[model samples]
Target: MIRAALVWLMLAAPLAAQVTEPDGFRMDHYRDPVPETVAGGATISPEGAYQLWQDGAAFIDVLPHAPKPANLPKGTIWRDKPRHSIPGALWLPNVGYGALAEVTADYFRRGLTNATDADPSRPVVFFCLNDCWMSWNAAKRAADWGYSAVYWFPEGTDGWTFMDYPTEQVRPMAPQPSQ
Candidate 1:
């Protein structure tokens, strides 16, 4: 009986920490945006948000690359995409910058390494598909990495495309300085 009881205790240990009193348990930082209640709980119009991004609001597009089969505005601006997309945003993928479900400590470590090594004033944004969870998770990961200015662009490519914003095919590799 004592052995069985010991086994039960061990099983319950992990569960205990995972459980919480409903009222005392709130994950404020990880919680969804307290939607503009006036505009409805989960849906925020993109007009305002897009303007904010364009106006130098640091943002991250979730896709490691721009949308496949790109549809974007024509002209010189459309060809060689800017590294700091949308004026001042940095491009960082939410899914560890590797293959799907590739998030590991190393993935996170490299992400932070790359981010911190860049301009500190750069606005970091994480994004993915419309209404997807990857960006949220990525943004949280970025926050965990001590990025004070992380933002999540939930509207994603769909929002950008629908609004007629230009998107590049895929950002080109940075040119190596000539030896």
Candidate 2:
């Protein structure tokens, strides 16, 4: 009985942290929320986002700012850097706000502050692993904060990598430790 109970507890432990409320449940835990531009909510599509990139719209890739490992498991990708980024996209990792529940007023402020610090008027595009909530949450948060134009690239890096586009490997700022 003791051993069985221990096993059950172990199995349940990991799941305890995985519960998430649906979108916009709280200021910090929302998923994909409506865009501010449309009176009613608007959904940004991948093709539409791709067109914006091709047309050289002002946008930034908010992946590098991720404070944790990318959701894309290693080995799933052949070469990680995009073969080519959307013509004029800038790289901005998600920093730490990777989920709606993880967000705080400070987190939103920091994201906007960091983004604006680079280019105040630039419309920002956020992304992560394809179909993940991190970028969606980030973009929605940005829009909620009154950013005029916030675009989300749902296809993420995998889409760019699969397309055989140009990409460059950016060395991390810190020195890699010897294996």
Candidate 3:
């Protein structure tokens, strides 16, 4: 435990200097180190998220699904990668992009409503992968959308799995238009 704390302290300073909270959504490099804090929302760790999950907080997974390339040969077999996330988490693909199309924006708004069962006061947790900015963007968007309780799990599935937390296959809240 002491060794782990030492290592983290050594790495945290250099990394802390490099990532600044963005004024707006991160427009690119979705997979990168993220800032430690997000405005208008709370940052949570795996244990905290687990406690909330136990309490039935709404969890939203904003990891985008990779689609098969249109340029692939007609007969080439393409298999979609599977996503396993925190149990009961709503999988809303592509909503984590820095910018949103009208359709995607609508979907996100509606998904939140549906996921929370129209309870605007329900605590919602947003997450993607470890060191990913997508979750940060989503959490901010949720807060801006007036979600009364919003939490950002920056470590996401990577952290969850690291804790040996149970996970299950999750599909999109609904069919998502390719972003």
Best by TM-score: 3
Model 3 misplaced stretches (Cα beyond 4 Å): 1-18, 176-179
How many backbone clashes can be found in candidate 1? 3
lDDT of 1 by residue, 35-146 (tens): 2111111223457557656666545554544433456555525433344334333445434332234444444445545544655444555555565555555655565555
lDDT of the candidates, in the order given: 0.48, 0.52, 0.92
Error of 3 at 4 (Å): 14
Which lDDT tens digits does candidate 2 get at residues 82-101?
A: 43345445454543254433
**Residue pairs clashing, model 3:** none
Q: For candidate 3, lDDT tens digit of each residue in 32-121?
A: 889988888999999999999999999999999886799998889998788999999999999999999998899999899988999878
Reference-based TM-score of each model: 0.45, 0.48, 0.87
Q: List the candidates ranked by lDDT, beginning with the highest.
A: 3, 2, 1
Residue 126, model 2, lDDT: 65
Worst 10 residues of 2 by lDDT: 33-42
